[model samples]
Target: MVVLSRRIRSEDWKPVGVSELEVNALQVVRSVDNRSVIAGPGAGKTELLAQRAAYLLQTGASPAPRRILAISFKRDAATNLAARVRQRCHRIHAERFDSMTFDAFAKGLIDRFGQALPERWRPRSDYEIMFPGDRDYREFLSRQIGVPPAHIGTYADIQAISVKTFERRHLVGTPLPLDGWLQPTPAQWAAGCYWQRFLHEGKKSFLSFSMIGRLAELLLRVNPMVQDALRLTYSHLFMDEFQDTTPIQYELVRTIFLGANTVTTAVGDNKQQIMRWAMAMDDPFSAFDGDFGATRTPLYNNYRSSPELVRIQHILAQALDVQAVAPVSKTVGTIAGASCAIWDFSTPGVEAAHLAAFVAAEIKAQALSPRDFVLLVRQKASEYATVLEPAFVAAGIPMRNEAGMVGAIMLQDLLVEAVSKLIVNVLRLAMATRAGRHWTTCQEALTALVGIAHDDEIAQAKFANELDAYVVTLKATYPNSPKSKVASRAIVEDILRFVGREKVVAAHPAYGQGGWLDEVLDSVAGHLLASSCNHTEWSSALDVYEGIHAVPLMTIHKSKGLEYHSVIFVGLDDGAWWSFANDQIEATAGFFVAFTRAKQRVVFTYCSHRGARTNIATLYQLLTNAGVKKVKIA
Candidate 1:
């Protein structure tokens, strides 16, 4: 092995911060074999991965010169893991940990080494990216003359077809079946036509995340040198949110290290797998067993919830699976009364007043802030906000619906998040005259990029000088201009131009070269930049942007992997969760995820007699079984 080791200590093995992990977690962390850690809510999955990374790096347990590669489903998740590692280990050892999203990893490989891909499948280096919603796919499906939706399947099914395997063998069945997915000759030819134009364009091919994944797979298959290099570079693979692994993601992982010498640890909870379709497997844990020879380790300590709250979660878990064992709560109760309760309301106004009273009492008695409480719904947080915001307003409580627009465009677009962070960082330095924390922060950011070399002093110095000059140019260009959409777009454009687009895209691989960036630029309006502040001083604006100043409200899907001191599940009645009948398992999983989001308390609020005296009978039964008291709000 080439001489490079960030090993901080000799062979002395013990976890560095956080000693609450049990024997099972410790075993999973230190085990050299492939493992699948499937545990319920708040079982310390992220903490376990961090400790494992620390063990490998500090103890020199892993093969020398190889790095630890962590692939998460979200960018924040990747960043969070990287941050935790940095907190737990030395800087040099932490530098050996590479964390990124699945999309970013795939896109990076293709961007750097796609020349080796097969000629027909290789995308142009200048390929653009597309993020299509149902409306776009609907228009495409409508144009087909005789194919029928049954032949090609729905837009959702068509969207699932991999660009890497769009051949007739994968699409068409022998006799052209009447129903189900991709069986007719017309469907096969039609899909091939779409993907062909999508993949091999004359001017510039259009690539989606799926197209990027397939191309990355093709590149790996064609280039042994690249595959060998990757295998040699990374000996440990830590996959977070493994239950949400999609088909393309699964195949790509298998393509890289199916039978390779890498130690892979996947950590997730099946009860929290609320994401749909493209997730691709019936049981990913079992799939992991068959493919990677992984040992399944289940963690049972409920470190997040109180005993009463865990009991409620257990009731729902039992309803979903008869053999489910309840996780023992490791936390002390914070509330003196019932930790889990249901409130029955006859009117919205009275219900609002009652909640305000309860919140005030709780704040006085327990010293909890508004941020400690969260309002969760099965779906449509914005619609519920229309009915509930008046309550918060009447009480002088600040509440925000996360599903509401962030900027002017898509709710949580990747490009918007990346570009926003970039501008904010640059602005921070632009506002700073000398080199201190600002320069260090910007330098750390540049070094942390996947494409940047931490050891390259010359490149680092050159980029640092460029950043200083860019800061100068930015202030000169704007010079105390009021924040507006036009000004925001121009500022963003100037920053992108000065720092270079390729550099930013390299930092954020999923910020694909497309009209989406232009759309995001258009949406970077004054409201988002200033947000609850009078001007563009960074700290004042970031307070609202980071959810520090308001009460939290969001859908259950968005609330996954998040925790609060108090969680209120709104709309327990049947109408709000009408789609539960379509898929009961998924519904139960969603409810389980929502209930476990509290460390001390969970309040289920229902307007039982407001409209039609409606209730979800199954949910009520579970609540009754869990011994939750129903309090009437008058």
Candidate 2:
């Protein structure tokens, strides 16, 4: 791939206000010693970013700076944008498009940071961070530390718990005695609280990748080499899904490129800022004026939807605080024959089942291709997999689960499994041979290994003694058991064998029978896991491609810049739907985003009970009052 002169003329680009806003944003970024962009939902932020990158690379006066670094919150978004840029450029610089998820970008930083750490402080693993989904460690911490389960739960729950714990010890004295007891100092209380948490659930392994964002910010701020190296290495910075960046990430961006002439543009829809769990928040609208000196623009003329569908969204926007700047109050989607349906599901399970049934019906009635529809769950919560999956399966709908690798054993999990297996092996060997001393040592290892291998440990003798004894046992049992072959290669092979490669592939959601699943999976997994050649290489799994039959479900954020023949808005007006402050903006913004997705028709469905009934009534009222002429509800 090589860079060439711009093939697309300046006149070829669309001039939506948002498009102009994006252009202006880039111009400011070009002038900024450093810059940040803030965009609201339906703002065409990503499109502007892609256009800006393509524009710069195509129009650069001289040697275009080394590379243009475009990052996304998701690997898919990054890869998609990279491809779009390649197409837009009319030529691709294979190395110039440094599009990667922030995590991937941070690992490069970690490589440098690891070397700077004191020898004693060297990290146990140099690999990517892993976050456990089960909250098992949190539960263990709660039990061990005498904190209620209600306190230390989810990531949010842990923060709340930490705050409560901090307050309980420092603000209130321990078990206020009937007779006056000596009150502890605030410092002493805080120290005791810290000790309690550390003694219980303070394992370093529990740190999530999000923490890397925090650490990376600190590194860039503190380390001149890191800051200089980044700014010097990359001259242009573009971010997609910019609204989803957390404060920590914002700090990281500031530290890396402060006072640099490098062009930096962040494009994202604030209404679509959905990753709150990871601390991602929509870039405040005011930030554009303050941080980047950006001018806001509206992309009101949606090219995706028809007039009727577009009008419907305008009415729904009243439910939220922000109004959608709809593109011309018209829908002109490609799928003009599509139909929308609204169904009332009284409960969560009912909603799940109704969605499943609706998808199944659509596949049959429309004779639609499986690949045409996608199911977009609200979050990556287990509720979808546990409850919704079963409903879909029970409905006899052959749906493709697009959820990423949940069933597969993560590397952290593998480490935990190996430790458990090692303890069992030691105990079993000692029990069979009746070696009391060996058994006792092995038991001590099992106890100590739990904390030592996983967390910092002051005692090294326990580890050394356990390793020496394990070697002795291996020597004694080499011929009888599969011992003495604990080399890295052999260990890997053994683990894979124990993991049952066949079983893993069989259990994979994507691997379950249709178009291109086998082919796509093979290509993706082959490229990603090329180092491992022990497994069979699959050429095609067309059977997997054939299974996609669900009514397409997707988040409104993903649906942006995309259109469907028919659109159904389910679970609308649920109090839970707009529980957060940002939720209101996203929901109203979603009304616009969702409406634009429909080609011919749109259906908004919610439960009859609760506020849903009132919600829909108000929607109808707004639509009729907004010159919709005739609004019908069935």
Candidate 3:
């Protein structure tokens, strides 16, 4: 509730190109005292964060020769904030700013201060960090816990349990049960054993993602030099999306900089704390005030949505008993009456079809781009994918579902590996001018290429004979050419064509008419031509592919920290939004987060029945009570 002094020193203050509300937030950010800003959706929190970094440099709040560390929850967010800061701040000041995700920061700290780690925590020279999909680590955990590998759920679940265990350990300074997590269950025992072995094997090899936080905490607690060095290195620390901070992450942050002279600012919206399943605290503000002793400043003005949209959001917040801050809209116009509506359908398929048709119509009528829209589901599964994806495809609307993209990327990798092997074979065959010298290698290459081309033995033989003739033609065509150059370009293309890459990709369930698969193929071909198609390079390409402009279909959880001009919230019924087990606090928070992502318009859809359950009565009551008009369709 305390506001920083607004009086600015004339020399230190400069126009940072923000509105008055944002300016107020930036002033608090630039102040030397620790501060926490509660920023709502589209509140320009990221802009304020960037300006804060710039302000620190321009005003000399962060003295020269010291860096400002800005940490975000995700790598893309960190990279984006860093880019914006560099653009706005002075060249010299921007140069001193380092931005990275929390994991990156922790990993870097451990890498730099490994020698300072405790003997048990110290990593051996052969130590390597294995992630969730690492086969060896999964098998090792399976063996340690006596649970079959199939029962381990997912890498994400394993990671969550690991972090939860570490959080307990950090809280009590030893691994003890603070809650039901300590119950003597088989899973709990496995988790405990897995944590112990993970640390035990750190002297040789270990697998981890959550352990980074624990290791960083240990280094900062035990090694004062490391703390002092970091304190001296960073004059200001800024954390974006602080609500998503796990207990261990916050502990690490507090351990290193709580009492230091470094000015710290944590910006987040408690209402947007929808990542509870990820170990995010339900009440993040208390930690800011009680744990860090930071002053709180709330940024209430919503600059992203129309007045009508803001009104609806306020109603939802009030119903959920969340802090309802009425956002003053900076948007110019009112949304159309139909902009917000609840569509009720008799079946899920009908609902999906109508939704897709509505999107197509909106894009055409309003001159909107497909990228402006998003379809958010409560969960990503076959239930939604089967109904929704075909609907979009039939409607001629482009949609990018993350699950599908993942499949496409996996397929792309397979194709790339096949291409690489084929090229290697072609080059080997070209080098075997005198047959006996490299006959075995040439034969192996030909056999592999033919095997990759067809399943039937007769077809494989035909393809192999054709490939041999084509190689002879290629050699004759480029008699003096370097084998690699010929193989990389011409031969690679021939192999891709012979293997029916396009046909196979087009037949994939993940393939859309938008030619995303074609784009992936083109990218793979480009990489193959450059002779640089490696896992890392292909993975980077996948990241780029995911960023392409298209209508996104994802869960509300995955949709956090992203905004769209129009958001369609599907399955707004009771079972999807409310559960009998809890008070639905987390679900309401998630709903609030999803609704606020809209920039101009929002729509909610629900089926009359979800499997054996009737439609969500509570959701119906809440919407009708809030005066939300409903359109029922059969």
Candidate 4:
């Protein structure tokens, strides 16, 4: 009887092997009156989200407006989902849906409201990049917690600590020092105070990306005009990875298009609520249909992985407070004749070497290329000493990172950051006009000009003297450096090249491909600084990765949305996943996310020798229950 039902039952509606879950979602979404979508893991939530978006797009009036807004928690996921939506819809009436990450969308909103803010916080015509200040926030906190800097387990730990600390101290304007290396000046502290008050009471505050959802909610309630504008802009909103959304995000969703925009659909698994630190509250899966009162739908089919992989995931899900129930228990395809075994080398160099060897074996034995496999680690820092660096070098495999982009035109970011500093410093120095260019050599001049009354007088003077000597060396030996001109450009180039080759290892690719992207970015950067201009371009590390031809060794979190022929989940220990942080209950969601990434073979490696009672044992029990055969625990 409803207009939505009329659209759903149209003759053009042909099922494309949608699981019962998807069908249920389509039916329920049509009658959306604020109900919860309660489903288990591997329930085709993402599929449903895509389908819901496609259905809305296809059935809508011809020549789709950019009314449908879909958002993802991560940039990659957003891109992937958008691709899927574009593919599913018919071209004759293709949907022009707008997509972006929540942070990016929030940044757009902030830019729109920039003029209303204080003068200091006014929007800049140029890029306003989020810069990391002097001291690494996590390193500082590690000292306060009495945890050794080396003892910091993962980047996730660092990020969590940083986010929490930033919220407590910087965002909230609470000036309590954590560990004393990086102290905010009086002015900085005052800025923090102002921001805190602004967030608490001010209608429009300078919000960090983490706090965007909260701000969006505030605007919805406080600014009806913005809400109406949003309604006109986005007739319907479909949020993917709903489980990861924080409480304030949910409130914002409700506040904006509550009555006029009733066609709201959210997709997520209750078992995958992993971002508790960012204030992501209860699982939005059930709340989508229940608390928010949208129609409920269940999607239980597992399409991404083989049955064996699904079984492994289902087994792991048992450890969670909220577990997903598998609809049809099917095993994944066999990685036949492929040698799969798990081994551990405690030391870093040896571990890297071992990983490289394993990758080599996979390439030789299974006919897999380096790009076919990915080596994922917990942190970017881990890639160098522990895994990919040594392994790749030992096996003669090339690798890429920020440094790999060297001399490449793609990496403008690194170039901009590095060259800007150099030019600023050069301008202060006021070096000779090679091309009548003004240079600033502040560090050199300031060292001789002043002295800290309470500090080491002799040593300070000596340091200043040494700095002057270094400047003289630059002027005489490398005049074409940052301080000099076109003639000096050669010297600058040589210094950058030498520094990169010797100390930084070509922070990017050189003239050829797979060298380092950093080089290209820096080269473009220097040119931009000299030219004084801006442009928008983008690139990725796909070349270095594909060329290396190695197996991926990475963390479960990093492994999200990535699949491989064979996935070996290392470090399935309880302590690693449970962590000291309070997000243990939600963290189990990662196990499902990781296990499902394996397309064929799912090999889980556990360190049973290290601990008395291992979480892997529990995982084993779950796997067996889910009908995973040939699962050996070693």
TM-score of 3: 0.69
Choose 2 or 3, whichever is better by lDDT: 3
lDDT string, candidate 4, 1-634, tens digits: 0112233444465433343445566664444344456555445555565666666655662124546787777665676676565556543222346667666565555545434433433333222233233253344334423322333244344334443445534442322232312454433343334344434433333344544444445445545787788877776677777778765566567677677644666766667666765557665665556655566566666666666556556556667753446555433565664223344434445545565676678677877765666543333424343445655766866443322232433231332333333433433243343412222234322332233222466765665565556555655653332322343345445434422433232221122122233444356444433332221110111122123333445555545655666665555445454552345465556656666666666554444443322534555456556655443322
lDDT (Cα, tens digit) per residue for candidate 1, span 517-586: 6656656544444452464554555445555656778888777777899998887878787777777777
**lDDT-better candidate, 3 vs 4:** 3
Give all candidates' CA lDDT scores: 0.72, 0.47, 0.65, 0.49
Residue pairs with colliding backbones in model 3 are 574-616
Predicted model with the maximum TM-score: 1
On lDDT, the leading prediction is: 1
lDDT for position 142 in model 4: 44
Count clashes in each candidate, considering only residues at least 3 apart in sequence or on different chains. Answer: 0, 27, 1, 72
> Which residue segments of model 3 deviate by more than 4 Å?
1-12, 125-193, 201-204, 320-323, 381-383, 403-549, 574-580, 612-617
> What is the TM-score of each predicted model, taking all chains together?
0.84, 0.58, 0.69, 0.61
Return model 2's CA RMSD, one decimal: 16.1
Order candidates by TM-score, high to low: 1, 3, 4, 2
Candidate 3 lowest-lDDT run of ten: 171-180
Candidate with more favorable, higher TM-score: 1 or 4: 1
Residue 359 CA error for candidate 1 (Å)? 3.7
Cα RMSDs, all models: 5.6, 16.1, 14.8, 17.1
**How much is 339 displaced in model 1, in angstroms?**
1.1
User: What value does the lDDT take at residue 518 in candidate 4?
Assistant: 42
lDDT of 3 by residue, 1-634 (tens): 1112233463657546554545567567657788888887888888888777766777667777899999987655676787677567644466678888787687767666766776656654334565543454445444444532454445444444443333333322332332324444334545555655665654454635466666778778788888999999998899998888877677788889988888888988777776676667667668768877888888877888888778887787776655566878887544466657887799988988888898899888888888789888887444677778788888987565643432234322333233343444454465345435444445544444333432356765666577678667766654433224444355456645654665433323222223444555454444444333322232232323333435677787767777888999887765665452354567667878888899888888877576322344555565666678988888
